[model samples]
Target: MITARYHREIPQRYRLEAGKCKKCGFIAFPHRLVCPKCKSQDFETIRLSDEGKILTFTIVRVASDKFSKQTPFAVGIVELKEGVKLTTQIADVDVDKLEIGQKVKIVFRKIQEDGKAGILCYGYKAVLI
Candidate 1:
């Protein structure tokens, strides 16, 4: 069984869906029920653009248990074209080549597996453009 945390994030993880506040135009990823900027409950579901730029990043030399085998991976906070920023792993490039302000595009990829016989969790990763 998928964890409640993982299950609830399917929309944002799979489709890049976000909640845009109708009152103050604040876009919240993971679809918050309330607007952070204006304290409004009015929102419209919006799909975020896949294209973005790398705002900041870090190389993980030491990783968590789930990501142990993938140590030294590059992760970044990417700012999408629509101004929504999301954290994602940077893929398909060498760590030495990564830089801030680099253009990237989101691609669906396997994020992790639950266990030896567990479910495969898929999510978006940033690919250099």
Candidate 2:
């Protein structure tokens, strides 16, 4: 279910669709209305590669208010081959085993919940391949 206030975060969950500027080779993750590199409105929708390299990471000892029960999770920025970097949760890895340049893949997952009566949110998370 969609659980974000911003519409841009929608594609960040279901599909890795992004916008590549026709004027320049700038890829925008979660997509862009205009190219930041060349200020071009002309763009092509591109699906990002599932594979990427972990650029940096951090273990969340103190989780968010929504994800408090899910503490000790890992989060990181991954650099795709398309030159787009995405920040997402790094799952299925020991918190003590995290390091820079770790190879990972984007996977669909449950991110958080609104409440007991609310929607079970979902999004793309990274898993060690």
TM-score of each: 0.95, 0.91
> lDDT per residue, candidate 2, 1-129, as tens digits?
354563546775689888888888788876779888789999888889999999999998997688899998999999987778989999999989989998999899888877889877778999998
Cα deviation in Å at residue 79, candidate 1?
0.2
TM-score of 1: 0.95
Clashing pairs in 1: none
Segments of candidate 2 deviating more than 4 angstroms: 1-9
Q: Model 1: residues >4 Å from true position, as ranges?
A: none
lDDT of 1 by residue, 23-88 (tens): 999999978888888899999999999999999999999998889999889999999988999999
Q: Clash number for model 1? A: 0
RMSD of each: 1.2, 2.0
